[model samples]
Structure formats: structure tokens, C-alpha cells
Target: MEQWKKNLVVLWFGQFLVMAGMTMIIPFLSLYLQFDLGLTDQHEIGIWAGIIFAGNFVTSFIFQPIWGRLADRYGRKMMLLRSGFGMAVVMALMGFATTPWHLLLLRMLNGTISGFNPASIALISSTTPKNRMGFAMGTIQSGGIAGTILGPFIGGLLADTIGFRPIFYLTGAFLFAASLLALFIVKEPFDRAKAAAREQVSVLQGFRQLSGIRELTALFAVTFLIQFAMMSPMTLIPLYVQELHGTTENLAFFAGFVGSVTGLSNLVASPLLGRLSDRIGAERVLGCALLGAALAFIPQALAGTVWQLLAARFLLGVFLGGLIPAVNALIRKYTPDGMESRAYSFNTSTLSLGNMIGPITGGALSGWIGIQGLFILSGVLLLANAAWVWQSLLRKRPVRSKA
Candidate 1:
């Protein structure tokens, strides 16, 4: 294989293993609280379960920017190593948890310590040539999509058949395995002088730097909106499938399938979109893609059958496929070279904030307004963000527009 292809594969595998560990906990946690831990009341269950999961995002939001800065000052490899070791420990300890509080603490620790994906992405971005960056990042992102597909399915199956404890053990083991992959298989082109001279910026400096970049600011805004809109889909899709009369035996499989298909779609679309973005510009692709996402949700809202919903999701996936790689590429296009990791860290933190807000908001809307309302709201928000980004980045088309 060529060097680009070789690096892409390693990065994808590394991300797949790391994210597999993280994603395993998401679908199973609420069930665990309700059945395994004996939290029976719906309100108590929601509150406690929310706490256990949200704690990680809260801690991660606070720490990601810091870690990104650290990655910039040190090296991407060092940051990846730290993330792998820290997450492995956290996942292992989760297996030993005895209560909700124990799980919450473990999760918080996981968030504070976890920064591997952003680091690995930064490394991939820095190591790959500019022309190939988008495809490279897209290929790696496909790994995350794969993990999302597999994690919940495996988590549910392992929990039901083998046991929940094994889920954690498996997660920890996978993360350790990813750590080794990062340590040995992944290679970086040397820039010893730049690496040695890199200076760590304060968290405030990192934040300030990200804010100052025009394209990055726009990207961040879209990040926030996309996250807020997608929260409902993430939290409620499985429930909706159940409402449509899907069987429990197929629940995990379907959920994983939805996620995996999205990744698969991205596998098909990302490289194409990335290449197109390089030709026509990232902003144009972003605007068109966001609009496509907004339109795709219409079918989702009106769907009367499982197949309809699946088709909608797959279409949504195709449109949304190139988003992350585009964001990273745009960030790279505009951000100072040495600050790549810090920029990604800020991006990750913004994403964490979205994760914190998306599910809760989606749950609330699903309960109060109805699922249709969730889709409507998500579509409207995305469309609005798409418009704003277009006006800011593409409409005016200033001579020096960073995008």
C-alpha cells in the first residue's frame, strides 16, 4: 500500500478500537441503572442516569482544551499515549463499580483524561499532505462510525449473555490494544525542531486563538448547532424503533446497524466530498451538505415504517458524512500550524458541550412536544445554521475570507 493508504488504515483501526471502548457504555448505561442497579422510579432513573453520563461530558468539556494545548506543546504521539493509558484505566475501573456514584466518578475520570481522538486526528492532519488531509481524516472518521455501530450492539449482547462487568473488561482491553497500535504501528514524519520549540498556551489563550479565526468560528458555530440538532436522533432513535414494533432481539442489532450504515455511507461519501471540497472549497460543500441534512429529516419525521426511517437515516448519513473532515480541514487551513492540537481540543470541547445538551434536550422534547417536534426542531436549527454559515463564509465572499 502507498504511505497515505497505510497511514489511513492504521489511524482508522486505532480510532476504531479507542471509540469502541467509549461507545460501549452509552446504550447500556440507562438499562443498567433501571435493572441491574435497582433504580426503579423513572424520575430517579433519569436523574441518576443522566448524572452518571453527563459527568463525563462536563469534565471532558473542561479538560479537552487543556489537553489540546498540551498536545501542541508536546507531540501528538505523546498525547495519544496519555489518552490511551488514562482511558484504559478508567474503563477497567468501571468494571469494578458498585454504585451509581462509583460509575459517575469513573466516567468523570474518563472524560478528564480522554483526549485521544482529537490528538490522533491532529496527528493525521499534520502528517498527511494538505491535499490529502480531508480524505485521510474522513477515512479515520469512518473508524469512529464503525465503533459507534459495534459498541452498543456488543455492549447489550455482552451484558445480557456474558455480563456487564465483561463489557468494561472488554472495553479496557480494546483501549490497551489501541494504545499499542498507536505506540508501534503509527508513524509520524519528523519535525524535531518544531516539536521541540512548540510552546504550551494557556487554556484562555487556546480559546482566544480559536475565536480569532473566522472560518474556525463559523465551523464552531455549525458544530454547536449540528450537535444540538442531532442530540434527539442519538437519544430517541432506538426508542422510536421500539415504538414501531421492533423486537428486543433485534434492537441492538438495528441500533448498531443504523450507526454502521451511516459510517458506511460516509465511507462512500467522505472521500468524494473531501475531494470536492478541496476543489470547490470546504465552505461550499458544507453549505450544500447542511442543506441536504435539513431536507433529509423531512422523511424521518413523516416515516410510517422502520424501513422508511432507515432510508432517511442513511440519506442523512450520506449528507452529514464529510462534515468532521471538512471542519478539521478548514481549521487546518486557517489555524496556526503549531496550534493544531489546541484547535482540535477546543473543537472537541464544543462537541462535548453538544453531547451534554443534545440528549437531555431531545428527551425533553420527545416527552413534551412529540417526536415529530424533535425532527422539526432539528431540521429548523440545522437549516438556520446552514444559512448563517453560508452568509458568513460564502455569501459575502470577502477577498480574505478564511474559508
Candidate 2:
């Protein structure tokens, strides 16, 4: 009934569509390069695929803060619409690309304009009641996770049925539709005059001001580490699954299951843990969840069977669910007024940086240390991150005396 609630509901769907559209290309990206683009060499196809896939994140990492600053000055809803519509056009053009270079450039362009998720988050964070912030962040996060879990599967199916190009058109159509939904339904109570009256700052100045705060700096690191740890083992999961299963038959199915199971559990746990964080404290939820996530990775490193690894990943998801929402809640609590969008944008930039670096580092390390050892290394990094959270956030809280 409330305007903020309406915005949250609309933006949840917006997040879902944005993530789903972005990920839909994953299923057939290499296939598109090899078949449609006429790349005959397998190695060339692989290289092109990697480049095109990372291009979006590469540009996204650089541009998120710029967009965030604009959102703070103009309006978050406008930024959201700009991204949604801009990405819609770029995604549709990918369906028409005649070369790998064309696709790569389009992907980069899409990433350059991509700010729908962060803008939605900033808008919701600004409008939602402080007490309900955890729940709102968690609920919105579940939307993206849900989209991530389903996008590839749906893309694969649609690619087979309607063919690859049609899937791109379909994704673009869905994204456009989502944008229209927000345009009509989502109401942002942005005080443009008030925002205009505030002292204007460059994006670099904004970044420096936010990063100067110790708590925000620590929170930013936590964001990066969480993404890095999760994404590092991602590209190597299939090899580990193969080792555990000891067979090639059904390998794709098993690997897909392992890849998606974490998101499935994460989707279920985010809202629940978010509510718990609201009742107790986001700091407590974050600390305990980090420790739980760190411990969960140990079993993955030790598992001798694919089933064991699956169970471990599912457990890890339960804890992973708490990290982002709690972090977002804390960011809102600590950020100075009128700069919330910039703060969230900076955090998103760190998130994109982690996403870009994680797979590369994971792929590199897995060869030297092996996948199992890589798992152990990831766990150790998370444990160290947990310690950082304690020192920087949890331990510094002023104790309240009981009446």
C-alpha cells in the first residue's frame, strides 16, 4: 500500500529481469561465436568467449560510480530506466552481431550503461524504513539469486527450441517490459531541489569521502572478498565434479546441479536471515554468517564424492545468504544522507571488480594448486575476512547498558 513497498515490489522484478537478461547469454555464448560468427578454431572460440564474457564486467567496474553520482544528483528511478532501456537495446543488437568483435563491443557498451541493480538498491535503501532495511535488502537479493539460478537453464532450453538469436530478442523484450513496469508503477520520492542545493562533488571526491570512513572501507573489502571467494572456484567446479564423480557420463548435468544448488539455497535463506538480522543486529548476523561460510568451505575441500560436495555447497549457501543484505543494511546505516546512491555505487564497483578478477585468479590457481587446494585457499581467505569484520565492525560497537 505504501509507496516504498510498491517501489520495492516493482524493483524486485526489475532486478530479476536485469540479472536474467545479463546471464541468458551464458548458455550459448561460445556456441554463438563458433557457429554464428564462423570462428572455426576451438582455441580461438574459447579466447573470444572469455573476452566477450568479461567485457561487460570490465566496463561495469569502471562506470558504476559515475552512474551512482548521477543517480544521487538526478534520480535513482531515472538511472534505473536508463540502464534497463539502454541494456535492452544492446542485448537486442547482440542478436544481430556478425562478428565476435561486434559482440564484444556490444557487451562492453551494455556494461557501461548497467546500473539498474545498484540504482534500485539505492532508491529502496533511501525510502525503506530503517528497521525494515534488512528485510528489504534480503528480499531484493533473493530476486537476483532466483534469476541467476534460472537464467542459464532457461536460456539453454530456449536456445535449443527457438534457437540462440531468438533467445536474445526474447531477453531484450523482457527487459524492456520490466523497464516499462517500473516507469508506470515504481514511485521514487526524490527531492530534486534538495539534491540540487547540496554541494556538488566529482565522482573521485565522492569516492574519497566515502572510502575515508573506516567502517565503509572495511565493508567494501568484505564485499570484494565475498564475491572473490565465491567466484574463484566457479569456473573449476566442473573439473572438481568430474574428479569426485570419476566419470564423464552425466558430467554436464552434475556440474550444472553443483553450480546452481548454492544459489537455490541462498534464495531460500536470504529473506529468513535478513529478518533475523533485523531482530538482532546486522553485525551479529554478518559475523556469524562469515564464520559459518568459512567452515562450510572446509567440507568442500575434503569431500571425496560429488554428493558430499553438493551438500557442502548447499550449506555454504545458507550462510552466504546473510552476507550481502547485512552489508547493505550497514552501508545505509553508516552512509551520510544525500550520498547513499554514491556509496552503493562504489560498493557495486567493488563487486564488479571482484567478479572480473575471481574467475581469472581461480582458474590460474587451480592449475598450480589443484581444485581441492584452491578450495582450501578460498576457505582460509574467508576466515581471514571474518577476522577483519570482527576487528573493524563487530568489536567497535559501543556496549549498551541494561536499565
Candidate 3:
């Protein structure tokens, strides 16, 4: 492999390991909070569970943009190293949690401190040429998706056999290994002349730079909506599965399968859709993906069995697979060289915010309205986004030119 490809692979695998380690907690943490710690009452369990789950994303959301700007100012490589090493230590400490509050605090701290994805992404985006940005981002994205796909299955097995705390130790050890690899294998080619050439923009200045780009601002709006649509399902689906089946047996297995299915869809669709967007345009491709995603939710709401849900999730994954890469490419197309990291950072923070909100929203909705309501609401949001984008494009084009 070429040097850049090698870097991409290492970064990808490192991220994969880190995400996998973090997500292992998801499959079993609720049970740990309820049965293990005796947090009785379904409502109380929901509240604490939501907090433990959303805590990390909320903190991560707050810090992501800050980390992004820091990456640009100092170095992407440094940020990646910091995130990896920090997460490794934090995850190890999680194994020692003796109470729900302890776990929740650690999870919150995990989010505030951890940032491997943003760091690796900043480095990758900065290094990639605009033409190949979609492919590069897709590859990096697949790593995290792959980890999600794998985490539940592995976690389920560990939870059933070895126990929850052991999984944390395993996660910590793996992350420790990943951190060492990241510190040694990944290279950030710094240009002192170029670094000096970059204007010492403040945080507000970075926001100002994004504000000037109308397309990116609109794209960021779309990104938040897209994440809101996707993340809620991720937060609720495992619980939904548990409620439906009335057992945790094979929960990880099913959840992992669902997660893997999404990755599989992305793995299959990203390159194909990306190449298609390159030929046509990202706008049209994204519009189609959004519409298809809205349609796919129908089957999910109507799912009568776990198999049906699995199938719906797999197909849903296919439709939404290329959306992020397409969106990232659009942002890259619009953003200048030095500013790419901050833009992505800001966008990711928004995504983290969406992630933080999604679970809370899903849990609340599931409590009041029902899971089906979530599908309909999320679908309506996506359809609205698609219509808005389509109409906005139409408004921007000169009718006389078409004539």
C-alpha cells in the first residue's frame, strides 16, 4: 500500500478498535445499571440509562468543535494521540465503577476527553485531495460503522459468559494497544511554512468563516437533521428489541447483526454512490438517499418480527449509506484547504448534539407515543429535508438557462 493508504488503514483500524471498545458498554450497561446496581423502577432505569448513554455524546458534542479547532492550530496527529491515550485510560477506569453515578460520571468524562474520530478525520480530510475526499471519508466512516456492527455481538457474548467488567478491561487493553499503534504508526506531515501562513483565527473567527459559506451553513443544517433521524433509532433499537423479545439472550447478537447490516450497506453503497455523485452531483444523490430513507422507515414501523426488523434495517442502511460521504464531499468541495478540519469539527459537534438529543428524544417518545411514532416523526423530518433541499436548488437555478 502507498504511504497515505497505509496511514488511512492504520487510522481506520485504530478508530475501529476505539469505537468497538466504547460501544461494548452499550449492549450491557442498562442491565448493569438496573439488575447489578439495583436501580429499580422502569422510569428510573430509563432516566439513568439515558443519562449514562447520552452523557458521553453531550460532553463530546461540546468539546468536538474545540478539539477540531485545536487540531487545525496545533496538529491533527497530536489530537488523535491525545484522544486515543485518554480514552484508553478512561475506559480502564470504567471497569472499577461501583455505582451508577460513577459510571455516568466516567461516561461523561469519556466524552469530554475522548476525540479519536474527529482527530483522525481532520488528518484524513486535510491530507485527501478534493476529488478523492468522498472515498477517503467513506473509508474512515466504515471503520466506525464496522465497529458498531461488531461491538454488540462481541459484547453480548462477553456479557453472557465472562461478565461486564471484564469487557471493560478488554476494551481498555485493546484501546491501549490502539493508542500505541496510533502514536507510532500515524504520521502528520506538518508544514512549518504553511502552519505559519495560516491566520491565527479565534474560535469566534472560525464560526465566522463558516457563516460566510451559505452552502456549508445549509449543509450543516441538513447534517443535523440527518443525524437526528439516524441516531434516534440507534439509541432505541436495542431497547426495543429487548422489550419485544422479553429477554436479553441474543440481544447483542441481533443488535450487532443490525449494526453490521448498516455497515454492510455502507460498505457496499458508499463507493458506488460516491462515484455516482462525482459523475452527476452530490445534491441529486443526497436527495434520493433521503427520500429512500424516508420510505424505508415504513417497513420498520410495520415490522412483525425480529427478522423483519433486521431486513428493514439492512435495507434502511443501504439507502442512508452514502448520505454522509456525499455530504462530507460537498462540504469539502466548498471549504478551503486549511479550514476543512474546523468545518468538519463543527459539523461533528452538531452531530454529537443530535446524538445526545436523539436517545433522550427516542426514549421519551417511546414512553409516550410509541416506537412507531418515532419512525413516522423521523421519516417526516427526512422527507421535509429532502423537499427543502430540492426546492432550494430549484430556486437557485435560473429558469431562463434551462429554457
After superposition on all C-alphas, the RMSD of every candidate to the true structure, in Å, is: 3.1, 2.4, 4.3
Ranking of all candidate structures by their TM-score, best first: 2, 1, 3
Q: Write the per-residue lDDT of candidate 1 for residues 94-138, one digit (tens) a residue.
A: 888877888888999999998988988888887887777767766
Q: Which stretches of candidate 1 lie over 4 Å from their true place?
A: 1-4, 30-46, 190-200, 238-264, 396-403
What C-alpha lDDT, on a 0 to 100 scale, does residue 266 get in candidate 2?
96
> All models: lDDT?
0.79, 0.90, 0.77
Steric overlap count per candidate: 0, 0, 0
Stretches of model 2 off by over 4 angstroms after superposition: 398-403
lDDT of 2 by residue, 1-403 (tens): 9988998899989888888887888999989888798999999998999999899999999999999999999999999999999998888988999999999999999999999999999989888997898999999999999888888888888988998888889889889999999999988889999999999999999998988877788889888988898899998899889999999999999999999999999999999999999999999999999999989989999998999999999999999999999988888888888888888999999999999899999988887887778778878888998998899788889343110
Model 2 global lDDT (CA atoms, 0 to 1): 0.90
As a TM-score, model 2 comes out at 0.97
> How big is the RMSD of model 3?
4.3
Candidate 2 pairs with clashing backbones: none
Where's the lowest-lDDT run of ten residues in candidate 3? 394-403
Error of 1 at 89 (Å): 1.7
